[model samples]
Target: MAPQDEPATTDEGFVPLFDGSTLAGWHAAPRTFGSVWPGGPDLAGRADLAQADADARAYPARWEVVDGAIEGFQDPDHPGFGGYLVSDRTFGDFELRLEMRPDWPADTGVMLRRRRDTWHGLQVLVDHRKSGSIGGFFGNGLANFHAVPYVLDVSTGADGTPDGLVLEDPATTLEPMTPDKPARLVRRGDPEAFLAAWRFGDWNRLRVRCVGAKPRATTWVNDVLVAEIDLATLEAPNYDADAVAAFLGRSGHLALEVHDNDPRFGEARWARGARCRWRALEIKELSPGD
Candidate 1:
């Protein structure tokens, strides 16, 4: 039932990352608004995502330890481009599990191997819009912005109406594993079944397992292994060519994100009305294939 990489510290199926008590093994590193890491772009700030902010003395701009959980809030007063609620360290070949409830019109994700100033390999998007978004890249390389493990034939676009169709495309055909044309299912389609695939305004379970050197990964939504990606090209030795020229480049950093520019999502989005915090988080053990 766990996303198998390394077994949880306990054996009750999966160990608790958030023991529902306190921040035991977690660290605090706030990525406050306006405080963009010394990275190149001004893609900085999480102010738009949050309504009010905590005391600047107690929490950093990017994160907080509230009610025994790690949470993010962008300054509603400064609704600019939001940045990542980054993890303090980098991880390799690990398993991760977390739950989040997104606000309406959000473009957010969990980024892995996120170098503060460079690129990352794995990114799983908790997209409210019914876009088949999965393992993509950001920063250094434009790896697979829409490279999904599976491309569904769902009706896409502002004018696309459901036409009752389903199809899959090899990752190579489309650049982002995203569809080439507007994808949609017909109106006579099973509403309950389609909705069941995703939950709106509710806490959804997300799990990821990364292994192997180049680090391929498997993603599970509510225990179903819905996607997989081969990270062979991750070893391309092209990230920060100058940085690599100094040393044998081999690894990357990891972090989480909240995307800006609230695009008009389609009806496929279940949580079209949700707003507020995404809670109950944990990251322990690396489940390889369970």
Candidate 2:
């Protein structure tokens, strides 16, 4: 079924993340990675979490509550600035649900099990740009494994503004899989169904359930199942599930990202002055019985 503008009925045991007025339980952690693509941060060594806690206070994003929703954008003074509005509390196994509406040419995502120090975790890609994909997974620091069903570009009208979205074959736009570096993982979903369920130029509901140390993440777009990844049983090259589990542990904070616009790409990663709006953010913690 297609998602409606009205918020989903709150399920039992679910709790609110955003207070709808202020960012009380959140902090900003700016990522200083040279580039956010291919691989986000080095995972060869563990970062000092204590030091990261101290450093996060210094950097902040232009995130604020507007009309009962959290709006995030890049700083106009420092266009190159990019970071996440991170939750102070960490989660282990949980089911997360939210609604997002991003402007054209925006590159933002929901970070899962993210480290406090850097961009290391599983990312649900909301790359609303050329050659980007929605409802997919990106391994931020785990060998850059991309598990998307299809790539997408903006469809433009005569005036050169975005009119709709155009779906493309991933094979044509993304790097081919190889033995040494198999970057792309198999995604579970029908592309046509995803397109039909997606609501262009409007708010879309996203649901994600992640569990275990080496997690099994399942995603839904407007209630259509789009992606499911079992990290422990994954067989992609250079993706070590055990190592990833060890590094990240069983719990981490949830984050909303505002990516930097790199000069090498020629075009901005995030559109100038464009902001992504989020609302109805909530999560339900899962126990062993669940």
Candidate 3:
């Protein structure tokens, strides 16, 4: 049964994903963004994820409603781990719009097409720090940006241990599709426009469009096109072309995320004590023509 404030599974046209009073249709994400990858814990080694899942369920304490907005406040004492408020239902082709404000050094973003088991999906970056670029596409569990524009070829020594490698090496074993012009992970049409459009220290509007079987996602920040991503071309280690294609076709949950605290990436210096807020969150489903 649906809660009183929960949105219905089927709505007429556009619908508010959040009810503003409670997290009726949302749950805490099973894991924190960017914590279990790269230099973090091994996902398979974590035997206590269930407890973390339970902690995620008790999200009211971590994420609360304040003045009609959902504010994510991080505990200064518990700095390293982060959490996500994820939608229970999954979505496919649609347009999602929301307004966000990052205080000081808060690192955050919106997640779409996120898989439950793999925890991999397309993340629309909302980083507001001077070194960060908002509206880039983050391929969860991938190399943090667009996949390599070309494939690599390895050369095997006499011992056959594969000693050398090169981009598009003629002796490559796997089939490589090196496009004449490979797609970029994030495409900001006009950097100047993006810079001018940003409303620093205030609410900034963001819109993301995901459509088609190949899922080309384009993001707009304050009415400026910040990025255009071909979801299929997004890459991470061990994710081959087939894996990427399958992920592109499947529907997955939508989420909002906070980057885990890490001193190496300057999170400890900047992200600690930071908070991010979201409001006016909504989504509109799309049809073939529309």
Candidate 4:
């Protein structure tokens, strides 16, 4: 059976995705808003992030309550491209439906199976300009250009795992789709098809569903289906592939992100059990299948 909080697939049916005006089931991570709050393990002073001096604000990554919603914006200068506003808890095997409208020229997506600011599942591309952008993050494993979009190339070493049983070369592991590739089934290997489909300058509606670790993601631009992907077993060398697989077999979080160097706007709303909006939020709980 699916977990109680799994998205869309409810045992009893009709679980609130968000409250009208608050982040109820979610918790803010340490460096949520700006950097961290002034007296916590999270960023309090200034998050030493790349382009920290850009649109980046004070610590805790200042999230504001605007027009009755919890909103986050991209810093025009930061280049991390994976800045996260993660949920403290981990989740799996559920459906998530949310409304998102990007107000900038940045790439966007959310994560599942994230731990301590690390992501282990997939990143459904909001912008269509990445290789395998429709594929999973494949952390320490594989990546589509959109997975880590600062550059079209990936860089890694064999030292990815503590035991070194696996070889991780971000350059090779993370494949990038370039502008030369076209969008045909045969062209899927060329990489450009991944980016050619990317659309910019618009509001996107996203729906993500995870059945254990196998995930299905789809994106819509102004209500038009722009992207879709279905993933089988998500492989990684950083964790015991089997154990990592099991951990994601139950529950996790609906962690949101604002990748570093991004210029987009993001907010999440649900009518679940809570009645609050998320600013710099964090949520923690044992991932499902624990």
Ranking by TM-score: 2, 3, 1, 4
Indicate the TM-score of model 1. Answer: 0.56
- Runs of candidate 2 with Cα error greater than 4 angstroms are 1-11, 34-60, 169-187
Judge candidate 2 against the unseen true structure and give its global Cα lDDT, from 0 to 1: 0.75
Worst 10 residues of 2 by lDDT: 174-183
The lDDT per prediction is 0.44, 0.75, 0.64, 0.37
12-118, model 1: which lDDT tens digit per residue?
34455554544443343333332222222333335553432233323332445556555554445444234555544456556777776554434556766555543
- Residue pairs in steric clash, candidate 3? none
Q: Name the runs in model 3 displaced over 4 angstroms.
A: 1-12, 30-61, 142-183, 233-239, 266-270
Q: What TM-score fits each model?
A: 0.56, 0.82, 0.72, 0.48
After superposing all C-alphas onto the true structure, candidate 4 shows an RMSD in angstroms of 13.6
Model 1 gets an lDDT of: 0.44
lDDT of 3 by residue, 96-185 (tens): 888898775666778887766445677877655433447766667643444222333334579875343233443532333433213565
Model number with the top TM-score: 2
Q: Report lDDT (Cα) of residue 209, candidate 1.
A: 68
Candidate No. with top lDDT: 2
Cα lDDT of candidate 4 equals 0.37
Cα shift from native, residue 29, model 1 (Å): 8.0
Clashes of each: 31, 0, 0, 56
Off by over 4 Å in 1: 1-8, 12-61, 65-68, 130-144, 149-195, 233-252, 262-280, 284-290
